[model samples]
Target: MFLISMIIWATALLGAVMTVWALTWAIKRGEFRNLRKGASSIFDAGEPIGRQTDFFPPVRKGVR
Candidate 1:
């Protein structure tokens, strides 16, 4: 019982430390500087913004 409690506490502490470290690293690297660009990184010229290009398998054939 004591050992299980210690393990859980240690795991929680480690998770919190890792989360803080990751946030700090991202801040130092300017990862959050360009929010809009990052949000649209997956899009391309062929698939412009506000345009729905993807269709599910069942609805794909009927689209065209």
Candidate 2:
């Protein structure tokens, strides 16, 4: 029982840390800026792919 609790706590902590890291990573990578502009650009199909908002998270270790 102790082992199981430790495993669960460790997993939860790892998940929380990874989540914050990813959010900051995205912001630093300019993924959240100009979100409205990026969405608007989608409708303008004729235009080339310009600045876009990345809503998806990065596939990192133990990120499910």
Candidate 3:
């Protein structure tokens, strides 16, 4: 029982440390500098904003 408890505590501590380290690294790397650009990074000229690129099956003509 004691061994299991110690392992659990150690794992929790490690997870907490990793989370803090990742957050600090991101802040130092300026990952949160660009808000809008990052949000639209996946979009390109072929698929601009406010444009529906995907269409479901059974698409009828002259039906938007």
Best by TM-score: 3
lDDT of each: 0.93, 0.86, 0.93
> How do the residues 8-57 of candidate 2 rate in per-residue lDDT, one tens digit apiece?
99999999999999999999999889898877765556555674656688
For model 1, the stretches where C-alpha displacement exceeds 4 angstroms are: 55-64
Global Cα RMSD, each model:
4.4, 15.9, 4.0
Ranking the candidates on TM-score from highest down gives: 3, 1, 2
| lDDT score for candidate 1 against the true structure | 0.93
Single out the weakest 10-residue window by summed lDDT for candidate 3: 55-64
Q: Clashing residue pairs, candidate 1?
A: none
Question: lDDT by residue for model 1 over 1-64, one digit each (tens)?
Answer: 9999999999999999999999999999999998999999988888888899877767566596
Q: Candidate 2: list runs displaced more than 4 Å.
A: 41-64
In candidate 3, which residue pairs clash?
none
Clashes of 1: 0
lDDT digits (tens) for residues 1-64 of candidate 3: 9999999999999999999999999999988999788899888999988899887777689876
Better of 1 and 2 by TM-score: 1
Model 3: number of backbone collisions: 0
